[model samples]
Target chain A: MPVTKMIEPILPVEKLTYLENFGHSLRAASYLYKPSSADEIFDVFKVAKQNHLTVTLRGAGRSYNDAALNGAGIIMDLTRMNKILDWNPETGMITVEPGVTLEKLWQHVLPDGWWPPVVSGTMTTTLGGCLGMNIHGKNNYRMGPIGEHVQEFTALLPTGAVMTCSPEKNGDLFYSMISGMGMLGVFTSITLKMKRVYSGLLRVKAYPVSNLHNHLNEIFLAAPDHDYTVGWLDATAGGSGMGRGQIHAAKYLHEGEDPDPQKTLRVEYQTLPATMFGFFPKASIHYFMTPFFNNPGVKLVNTAKYIAGLRKGEHLQSHAAFHFLLDYVPNWELGYGKNGLIQYQSFLPKETAEATWNEILTISQKKGMPSYLGVTKRHRPDKFLLSHAVDGFSLALDFKITIGSRDKMYAMLQDFDRIVLQAGGRFYFAKNSETSSETALQFLGEETVKRFKALKHRTDPDNLLESNLYRRVFGS
Target chain B: MPSTNRNSATPLKPGKCAIIVGSAKGLGGALARKLAREGFVLGLVDRNSELLVQLCAEINAGNVGQAFPYVQDVTSYEEVPALFQKILVDLGGLDTFIYVAGILLPTTPTTYDFEKDRLMISVNALGALAWFNVVAPVFQALHSGHIVGISSVAGDRGRVGNPGYNSSKAALTTYLEALRNRLSRYGVHVLTVKPGFMDTDMLKSSPRTFWVVSPEQAAEDVYKALRQRRQTIYTLGRWGWIMFIIRHVPSVIFRRLSL
Candidate 1:
């Protein structure tokens, strides 16, 4: 009996050194493997112990850098483990393997009058990755995050054993595993709490605000009563018209609101398009319709989009629109053309927002490139390891990606990062790409980092995994 | 850089979850995993989807906190607010929110660029304020939590390199001061982190620096400050001292110096 056959399906074991990352920008060459079972996971760990090879896990291949790419070690692919074991609508709980995508879970449970309690920005994110990341969704103000709703899970401990963890049993490991970002162990199957929904259609109101205060105070106050909410700040506007932008808030209107008899027969929220996962980024630049904005004046077209939104008969399909809204407007980012695109977002403490915004805008004038649009919103930070949220305001900007961008953006990023840090605020990692590693450590600290390394050693003592980001932050 | 036993040297274990907003591959990312090893979970918030998902998964395998990755323009009130609410349900609420999300415009010395100025303000100051409005109530209501913001030496006064960033940081510092004063009574600790020069991807992409500290080291300092609840912490410690003098410098002397 060769010890690697039955367990072989759990993980793909390949002795290669030059493993490239998801973004195709970072590469690590060592060993690659994909494990689909708990025993196989342990076997991979056992091999690493015997071979003294570092280890790292791979999911969906959605990460930008090297989180899933283990160099000079084993890259365990959890994709094949995708499975939905159990789902109970009454209890609002569902169980599945780590590889399950929120999209897949939607297909299994949405039709049964249940929805994943919360979803990340995208549908393709894996359940294990979601649990590892403790993802939050559009209804965060009321629902919180994915970790909050998780009831229990089975994670392969770094000690080469499978353990069950939750708030009650091995609660510490449960908390650690849910938000640990794979530092604690590999999650095999997890039971997630779900949410109740009345219908598949959502009625959204897109109203405009003129300044930051209203956007924060008025908008966030209505989170609980509303099922879904979001607002946009005009980064290009200022002075008396600070928050003069759009706020698009939505909620499921219930079946009675629509009164469509055809919708009454168990309207199942359709699964997201598979291509969406593969089509992560479609557009390059955030350019306005130059043809419309420039308007050569020769062609007369009646486009009243600048005035208000929606036509006479139009409502969004809750399941399809929210997750696939960007998909409908395909290649919208391409409007910026050759310059590419730049998307920026920042968060500041509530207290000094007015003054800090003034200073930042005062400085922004120096940069030749400026955003045409902006949006402001509120965020409540979660406990998931490196989450980015706080009691404050967040503003986003879109620009044409350009050549001097690195320098142009870094200067502002540095200043903005420093300001938020000093103001008892933090930045959003999802929207950033140029923050310096040194500054990154400053915000988190070195001691905490060391503990992370030690924990990794204790869990996977043999070091069988690696990722681009892992090497970047912990390689030394 | 040599590793430090963060708890022994400073304070705090590594089992908490930290939210780093501007953490794709810089200071925010460094702090994210640093704390992850410290036994803390990671919640990475950023607009860069590619970077956000990848980074979160990497950290997930290393720790137990179940790093959650959220993609939203931090500045977008609709996107981030909803994200936070979802996080509340997902991660079981707040432990710490590390505000590292920000953007840099061109460094020219002109205020005529209306668009650039607007972005600077929106991304730097307004976004920060929006986040605060949402989390303050949560932390205050819970009666315990921490709000850590990343500030800079440039914010002390109008800097020559980029006045927009200088002003943004200045505003952030002042805002946090006010927020700390208000939220302290409710058991929410507010920490202001200031670093002189950080060796992040941003710095690596730019000119080499002698004073720059690696993102990992910077992350350690942040964790230290959070554990100790140091209200106003400078990552390198010495940076605080350096800025102390710089802040008090009169306009005449300060403006005259090339620094």
Candidate 2:
């Protein structure tokens, strides 16, 4: 058999010094290939294999960490391969190339009264990234993660085998690739079961909660009736007001119930205004916010947000506006400065969520490094091999990176891991940057880790598909 | 011209039916692929019958949209009206008509060739006008359609390096503007696309070009501009400001600089 059928000349590998992720963490990669088609993807894999270079697949580079970055190796940028392969309105099945972003998918399908079953906080993230991380949304409790709605997918394995896998076909590979973080292969195409929608508006209600107990209680109470439920926790809240925040519950409006007179089935999704954050220099904003990155300033901002949420209790919003809250303030992460930011999201079982969440908050407050933003969401356990959900609640906290906060943040994360592991909780890989191998092994359990390792070995025996994240977490 | 019913009960899919001129290769081909992927039943026109047939087969195999190839050169101005009418009938209706058929001949002020200049002007300017003459009335009759013309940033000002190509693009841009002004009253949109240095075969031999975007990037910008109902756009966007400054330069200074 021919080792390679060279269609396009493999461009000379160039050194890229600053492959900065969304969170502003920079890494180096030896080569970057923007393959525009499936055949090109296969060629990329072959070239990587020939050169004995580990390949890391990147879609949109929105992972906030090293998940999409590979130090001194090839980075396969899949954004150019964006194309919708097929759409069947009768069955609500849409087949799309892996590079299609959620925004583009919504733009194509929403006009046809179809919506993605699950959408992450930002619409810029690609389908491939969602599948790789097995991302969950606010409605995860109802619709599950993106992987659950994925009917099938075709991936180019490191062995140069193009396999179509689904729940009914190539079942083992299907499960492995769902949350495999693109270790098993590069996804070429995905067939998703898009949910049908009657209108583009969402009816949302917000309630202010006092403490961790109230937050958990409100989420549990809202979960049964709401299609989507999520809460913004005030991390700076201490003592009596600890975990005080607002819980937002929403559902898609019926066909005729939308308040907008101009409402149509084909609503155009609005992008964030360029002037939304004002015309301040990004670096200057970061510098100004550095002093306010502490407990008191964050508390005041959270308090104001709480009051604003209370004032706007019930309202109608476009589906895009409701789901993509992060996009409203363009470059919001720039406020965290050049050192970047790290998000640590931990999921704990419902039985121990209240106490463990309190402990986590207390540790941050005591360290004087309280998180700037905290969000809570309910999740149901999924069957994917490396699933992060646990039929419980997950608290995601964002901490700014300061001059000497790396060691402090790592030390604090270690403490968090100990508490979470003791409480039978686990960490999310999408937002993780400093998770240790031992912590990951302990959190994932030995049997599951061993099984994943065996599968990884079978798919990539030569370790062709490797990333810095893979080495840090899995220790391959 | 066949008149499409404006009040038909069938809902308007955003980009249902599109006709792409010069759909055989480069930026035109990229746009054809993108529109098809976005669920537009396409009428692909090109002089290269073989490549057009291959593209149609590939698009059909992908199952994104139906592609119908029309192997008529745009230079044949008399054939465009009948060909467009046939395409409209075959595709059921029209929603978008993108004229991307253009040529760039290497003719400087000192080495001006009459044959090359005529070919460039006919293909890039008059050919676009031929398609617009046919398609604009159809879109007006329907009162709901997008007419896009791919002009060039070189159209912003004439340069000595390639005067023929620049003037041709300038004429196409002005024609598109006139069309937009006339079509606006009937709810029809006209977008003039001005792209800078794109990494296409057309620019393969061009030296020292900055901010070169891929055809895919240019195609994406074109699609976005269409969706936004923009009057005119610079693909990869920054070229707008670059051209703005270049257009405002004094003749004394401009004559001294070799762009």
Q: For this target, which candidate reaches the highest lDDT against the unseen true structure?
A: 2
DockQ of 1: 0.01
In model 1 chain A, which range of ten residues has the least summed lDDT? A1-10
> In lDDT terms, how accurate is model 2?
0.81
- lDDT value, residue A279 of candidate 1: 71
Q: After superposition, how far is residue A234 of candidate 1 from its true place, in Å?
A: 3.5
TM per candidate comes to: 0.54, 0.62
**Cα lDDT of model 1 by residue, A1-476, tens digit:** 12221111111222333444322333333355677788888887777665544466767655433455543345677888988898787877899999888778876776666767777655667888777656555666666667888888888875767788878897656655665556568999898887766666667766655566666665676565677667655544546755445566667767566565235324343534334357744342223344432112101221233135322233565665675454444445455444334445666666765566655654554564445555565556666545555655666665444444544555675787677567666544334434445654665567655655666677655454443344444444
Q: Write the per-residue lDDT of candidate 1 for residues B42-160, one digit (tens) a residue.
A: 56788898988998788777633457777778667545555665454334235788787666675554445666656777777777877777667666655667998887766788866
* lDDT of model 1, residue A234: 52
Candidate 2 chain A has its poorest 10 consecutive residues by lDDT at A1-10
TM-score, structure 2 vs. true: 0.62
